[model samples]
Target: MRIFVCIKQVPDTETKIKLMPDGSGIDEGGVKWIMNPYDEFAVEEALKLKQTAGDATVTVISVGPKKRVADALRTAMAMGADDGIVIDCENSLDSFTTAKALAAAIKKEPACDFVFSGKLAIDDNAGSVSQYLAEFLEIPHVTVVSGFEASSGKYVVTREVEGGTKEIFELTGPAVVAANKGLNTPRYASLPGIMKAKKKPLSELNLSDLGLSSSDAKVSFTNFELPPEKPPVKFIDGDPAAQAKELVRLLKDEAKVL
Candidate 1:
């Protein structure tokens, strides 16, 4: 079996974020970067699948600035990925363009049974890459997957849905899987694993290497801004009936939910 897992390097959640001088992106200076937390689940799931099959190969792939992505690939490899591939993007790409670049790299492989990725990257929180990748690959994709079972070329997966519902799906190989939290506990890289990962075969790629150009990008980032501060809560204090009436009035007049 040939499995491909996509990951991203994102700012550590606790790190304070600041905007760039041009307001087009984040200010990375003094900020710590790590493999996206959600993608860790995806990588762990891929490794588990490979272990279950006993003869499968897992390839870890990502697209980002080369300097930032190198450590991410090394971390994935240390977690037991068989190989690693990094795509050097000249500029940060939106989800669609990123997925396009990833899809092109996956196509370069001889054959792939599965492609797995995190449901969302924490930095942008845009949980759309797997859907776009599936579209580009023209395969079935199950997102927010929390459960999975595989035998032969068939797969059974449970996807988390709104209102605490879990939707089960059955799909065949050559599909995409968007791993979510609770899928599996990610393992830490052991000393030996880290040493071995340092020697693993890693391939670096560029847009030109994939026969892609900047013109292929369909979206652009014009500016970035922090979210507005949340308003303070207001209380309706009065007798029971008066409070109820005031609550209704507030909802209708101020909250606009009526």
Candidate 2:
């Protein structure tokens, strides 16, 4: 069995975010990018499956630009993926176009029995690419996957819904699942794995090579802008009973919650 895990490059969670002078998007300059968190879970899950399904091979694919996307690929390899493919998109893709690009890559590669991706890219937070890619590839797609089990050429997926509801889906091979957080514990890249990762092959392909065009990406962003700062918070301090009374009064009168 062969599995394709799609990963994305995103801003590090701790990286101080600044808007690019206008409100459209993030300021890329001086920003450090990391793997999309949910993608890590997807990678972890793929690695787990490969371990269970002996003779299975796992491939990590990312659409991005870098002097080298090696760093991201290295991370995946260190986690046990066999090979990597990089689509040189860098900062020029939107959700719709990216999904198409990945679908093209998946088609070219062939032998992909399953595809896994994070539920959303952290920086953009547009959680539509995985579903779109499934659509583009003409395969079943499901999101927010909390648990999954694969066998008999089919997969049973568990997910959470609004208001604490639960949903389950059964999809066959070649389907795509957008993994949710907590799917698995992501392993840290060890010294041995990191060293081996450096030796792993990382192939870079251009947009034309993937048959994806920047023009197909419709959204236009002039620049980024910071959201308005919130006013300072006020606290009411007193004994427990006094605080409870104050809270009740505030909720009823001050906040007009009556």
Candidate 3:
């Protein structure tokens, strides 16, 4: 069996982000990049599935600038993926165009038995790519998956929903599964695995190679700016009863929540 895991290179959550002077986008300088944390779960689940199947191969795929995305793929290889494909593209593509590019890239390789990805990228947090990919590939997809098992040539997945309930699904054919956190513990890259990853095959392709272009983007971003500075806190100086009245007055007149 062949499994494909999709990942994204994103700014580390702790990294301080700066906007471009013209508000076109964030400044890339001095930014620390890493694989999306949720994608790590997807990769770990793929590796676990590979271990269970014993004859399976896990291929990691990403769409982004060559150097950064390639680095993310190498990290996945260090975690046990067999090979990788990097679709060289601008970092700002919308989710639709991104999914289209991924589907095209997957079609260029041998057909895969399953596709795995994070529920969403940390940067955009759009939480839409895997569904779009399944649509483009004409396959079923389940997102926010927390449990996964395989039996009888089918996959049974469990996902949490609103109201703290869980929904289970069984997919009998090739399908896409977007992993959420708590699915598996991601392993850190070891010294030997890191050394071996340096030799793993990584293919790079361009948007044109995938029959896509910048015009295919369905959404555009603009007017990027930081949120306004918060106002200072105000104190109510009064006894308990008076404080309650003042709070109610403030809420009704000043804050307008009443």
Candidate 4:
């Protein structure tokens, strides 16, 4: 089986990021970077699938500044992805534009049996890339999947839903799936594995290298804004019953949700 997984480098979840002065982007000064947490699940799932299919080849692909993305690829390689593809795009566009670039690179590779990605990147939280790729490739797509099993030439997946419900989906080859947190625990790269990754093939390509250009995709972020800061929190001191009543009253009056 040949599986291609998309990964992303995002601001470290714990970092306090600031917006750029122009208000159109983030201020990259002190913000640290890490592999998108959700993508870790995608990597783990791919590694697990590779384990089941001993001859499988798991390739990790990302689009970003080459220097910045090596850390992200190293994260996947530590967890056992066999090779990496770093699409050397300026990445000045949003997620949809990035996906189009990724699709172009994916087309350059041998047709993959399955394509997978994290549910979404934490930074932008635009959970549309995998679905868009599936649409572009004209293949099956499933998202927010918590569990999966492949057997008898088909894939059985459990999709998460509201109110603790799950939807099961069965699909065959040439499909896209989005992974969620509970699917697997990501493995940390060992010292030896990190060393091994240095020798692994990492293909770097630019837009021209893939015969793609920004004009081929259309998407834009008009502006960027942050949510308003919260008002100071208040504490109502009283016994349990009184506090419950006060809480309900506060929610209805202040928060405006009953």
Task: Go through the candidates in order and give each one's C-alpha lDDT.
Answer: 0.90, 0.84, 0.93, 0.85
User: Which candidate tops lDDT?
Assistant: 3
Clashes of each: 0, 5, 0, 0
Off by over 4 Å in 3: 235-258
Better of 1 and 4 by TM-score: 4
List where candidate 4 sits over 4 angstroms from the true fold: 215-217, 252-256
Report the alpha-carbon TM-score of model 2 versus the true structure.
0.93
Residue-wise C-alpha lDDT for candidate 3, range 1-258, written one tens digit per residue: 999999999999999999999999899999999999999999999999888888999999999899788999999999989999999977658899999999999988877889999999999889999999999999999999999998757899999899979999999988999999988889999999999999999988999998999788998888999999988889998899999999999999999997
Residue 199 of candidate 4: its Cα lDDT? 82
Error of 4 at 162 (Å): 1.6
Between 2 and 3, whose lDDT is larger? Answer: 3
Among all windows of 10 consecutive residues in model 2, the one with the lowest summed lDDT is 218-227
What lDDT would candidate 4 get against the real structure? 0.85
Using lDDT as the yardstick, the better of models 3 and 4 is 3
**For model 4, how does the per-residue alpha-carbon lDDT over 1-258 read when each residue is reduced to its tens digit?**
889999999999789878877787888889798999989999988888888877899999998888888889977887788999998766544666677777888888876888889999887788889998888877889999899898855999899999989999999777889999898788888888888888888999887776777666666664667789988889988999999999999999988987
User: lDDT of candidate 2 vs native?
Assistant: 0.84
Write model 2 residue lDDT over 1-258, tens digit each, in one string: 989999988879989987755567776788887888999999998988887777888999888785545578779999878889888865748888888888888888758888899998887798999999999989898889889897877788988889978799888677898999867888887889888887887777878997768889866666466667888876889999999999999999888988
Q: Each candidate's TM vs. the true structure?
A: 0.87, 0.93, 0.92, 0.92
- The model with the greater TM-score, 1 or 2, is 2
